[model samples]
Target: MTYKQEQLSEEKVFKDPVHRYVHVRDRVIWDLIATPEFQRLRRIKQLGTTNLTFHGAEHSRFNHSLGVYEIVRRIISVFEDRPHWNKEERLLCLCAALLHDLGHGPFSHSFEKVFKLDHEIFTQKIITGDTEINRVLEKVEKGFSQKVADVIAKTYQDKLVVSLISSQIDADRMDYLIRDAYFTGVSYGHFDMERIMRVMRPMEDQVVIKSTGMHAVEDYIMSRYQMYWQVYFHPVTRSAEVILSKILHRAKDLFEADDFTFKLEPTHFLSFFRGDVRLEEYLKLDESIVYYYFQAWQDEDDVILKDLCERFMNRRLFKYVEFNPNLQMKDWMELYTLFQQADINPEYYLVVDSSSDLPYDFYRPGEEEERLPIHLLMPDRSLKELSRHSDIVEAISGKKRTDHKLYFPKDRIEALTDQSLKKKIITILYGQGEVEDVR
Candidate 1:
């Protein structure tokens, strides 16, 4: 048999907390997993700074990736005998599922935001670039690496294949929801994943759920909604993220400043700071490497960089208050000026973070980021959008909810010797004797 057709003599199983057991029988998958690029995921935290808030959320992308592969494995098993399900695409789907998150850097989203990088673009690069992952994929077949890259890029010719990985209710989402919930020790991310998988039907261009499984799909949607608010977007987690982003910003600014010299060279981040990160440099960075820099930078000459690093390393996170940009613009401006006058750098210390989510949405073409609506297969084999059939989904569908928080160093403000300035900032943040403990 060709390498592409090779199977393991005995299936390799990973005992997983979320999926019970992740079974791997394909030799190609085994080889891919052994690749250094894939193994690097072991060091990258799945939830970034969320560990600060939910102490148990220390799982790695490696765990989540395997769960996704297992979920897709079970899903393809059901599709094996179904119409419109291409057997040739089975390995492709599995490979994509396993390697979908390959390019996530340390503290994934924060790094992306500060560096102007997209993990998806890096994912395609890793699959197609000069790398062991590409070599493994190339061994599958000529041009197979590009096929995997295309699947991940959502540009593959087979829309059905793309949907299996990138659609509204794909294996990636299913795994992360439950897997994140399991690690975070939260009840919000649980749902009948087995039921959803069993009811999943392959179609010409996408996967659909049977009418009988509408409730299961609804549960899944609501679980995602709750997970976002209860755990994923927890205020404490956001606070850590804010500090992390500020650290990156400070380091980058210092790098660009001619007078600033680091106590220790930020070797791993130089490429990111310079905006010319190559694949090898990108892969070499993990949470440990980042933490090492954050620790070392605590002793740096740059006070802002040193302070931010210390705060991140020691969990001296900034406190946040509900902020409305529109109604409180004048107040925000006044606070920004007061922070500067009080010897605090407003650029690094005062930040407004906004998080928004649409739990569910029907298709609306021509929108900036169009979400392909979930569809339920009717008893008569016709298709209906999810919200159309489920009232629970309809009520929340198409409704976008946004939250805005103004984050500042409460400790620093409280420490100020200038009594009048401190009182003004406090009054603005907490109206009239409402200065309760934020933590």
Candidate 2:
């Protein structure tokens, strides 16, 4: 089948909070979103368990997909009549943006960790395989679906289209940074997006902000830096993630041992436990279904399963404290023993959480996962690498920062019937003082 862009009789608009209105002019994009595969995003929260910490973060990836499409639409508007910006690439870029996250399942991060599934691969399949998305893409032209897939895969021959959706600073990142910040009510992600869009110019191989707009680029980099530390890497979110991961591990262990009796048998999880997940089964799983199981599993006889479900649903997040990996191995071992003595399963109750990110990186030749360093197009038509010209960017480039925490249930330990064991655990975990709130 060939792919052709078909216009809808009446253009549809999604009332978006960030972009105001996400307009869909093409029928293909509309049908793609309406497909059950894409609609599943409505059930998958954009920030995962971050909603546990930030109640307002209840927005879904469905919101983000629209936001990214709107951003790309704006960028494409800028690219019109510009050098190296091919107008023909418009539909391809839009398709890639809309379908980029079609593969993500419910509670994406935790599911990915437990099942070892890569959303990217599933995304490719949805676009190129036998599905409504593929059928829509094939309507454009033969091989058009592949072209869109190529853009998403970052292998499209057109560098401009590839860069528009998947660069150091692309539409996806631009949307999520601002959208996540808005929903999470964090100030760190407020950047001049309009200014960035105005300055963006299509280059031979990438997009570059004009020299005069260097300040806007600096602001964007800084916004990302602050957002990472302040929101994306928040410890409370990680604590929930740690608990979620342990729940899956313990459930899988119990299923294998045949010691667990689930009110609702783990049908959806069987393939994952066997290390083989069909796309259909994967697509059927969403946050609502998971929450339904969590509700049911709260009554399971297995202590760990029941406890974890209650913890996740009620937002009884694990308490965390600063940990230094190099110096804390012995302490971690001791904590594990203390957890055993306290009758808390060390495997499910004790966890180490670490998060690291580079705010920005300078071009280092031949580095794997090398980001296309931002450039400023000067008045004289010369290109300059961003860090060379921006003092703030230069100050932060290549600096990777990491945070680590040791997580446990503080309330449970505090309520233990065995006073002696509780005291020993508390002393070993926090060293004579009550555990401080981790926020």
Candidate 3:
């Protein structure tokens, strides 16, 4: 048998908390997992700064990637005998599921936001670039690496294959929802995944759910909504993320400043600060490396850098209050000016973080971010969009919810000797009794 057709003599199983067990029998998958690029995920936290809020939420991307692969494995097994499900695409789907999150950097979202990087682009690069992952994929077949990349990029010729990984109810989402919930000790993400998987039917261009499983799909959607508010977007997690982003911003600014000299050279971050990070450099800077820098920068000469690093390392997260940009523009301007007068850099200390979510939405062409609506296969060989038939889903469908919070160092403001300035800031911030000390 060719390398592409090779299978393990015995299946390798990973005992997983969320999926029970992840079984691997394909040689290509086993080899790919052994690659350094894949192993690097072990050091990268799945939830980033969320560990500070939920101590149990310390799982890694490695855990999530395997969970996704297992889910897709079970899904493809069901699809193998169904119409419109290509057996040739089985390994391709599994590969994409396992490696989908390959390019996530340390503190993934915050690093991407502060550095203007996209993990999806990096994922494609890792699969196609000069790397072990690319090498293993190339061994699968000529041009196979590009095929996997295309699947992840949502540009593959087979829309059915793409939907298995990228669609609204894909394996990636299913694994993360349950996996994250399991680790974080939250009940909001619980749902009947097995029911959803059993009811999944392959179609010409996407996967569909049988009418009998509509309630299961609804439960999954609602679970996702609750998980977003209860665990994923918890205010305490956001506070830590705010501080992390600020730290990256401060470090980058210091790196750009001619007069600023780091007592210890930021070797790992130099490429990131310069905006020319190569793949090798990107993979080397995992969460442990980032934490090392944060620890060292605590002793730096720059006060802002030192302070931000200290806050992050010690979890002295900034307090936050509900903020409405439209109604509080005057107060915001005044507060910005007062913070500057008090020698507190408004840029680093005062921040507004906004988070928004669209729990579920029907397909709308040409929209900025179009979400492909979930479809349920009817009893009479018909199809209907999920929200169209379910009143529970219809009520919440297409509704976008947004939250805005103003984060600032309340302790710093309270420490100011200027009594009048302190009172003004306090009255503006705490007047509504919205001050949240996410300690």
Question: Number of clashing pairs, model 2?
Answer: 10
lDDT of 3 by residue, 102-183 (tens): 9999999989999999999999999999999999999999999999999999999999999989988999999999988988
Cα lDDT for residue 400, candidate 1: 89
Candidate 2, residues 283-378, lDDT tens digits: the string is 778888888888888888888899998998888888877788798788789878878987898888888888999989877888888788888999
For candidate 3, the per-residue lDDT at 279 reads 91
Cα displacement (Å) at residue 114, model 2: 2.0
Can you give the lDDT of residue 388 in candidate 1? 92
**lDDT of predicted model 1:** 0.92
Question: Which is superior by lDDT, 1 or 3?
Answer: 3
Question: Where is model 2 more than 4 Å wrong at Cα?
Answer: 1-5, 432-434
Global lDDT of each candidate: 0.92, 0.85, 0.93
lDDT of model 1 at residue 407?
Answer: 88
Tell me how far the alpha carbon of residue 317 in candidate 2 is from the true structure, in angstroms, after superposition.
Answer: 1.5
Candidate 1 positional error at 133, Å: 0.4
lDDT by residue for model 1 over 8-58, one digit each (tens)? Answer: 999999999888899999999999999999999999999999998888999
Off by over 4 Å in 1: 432-439
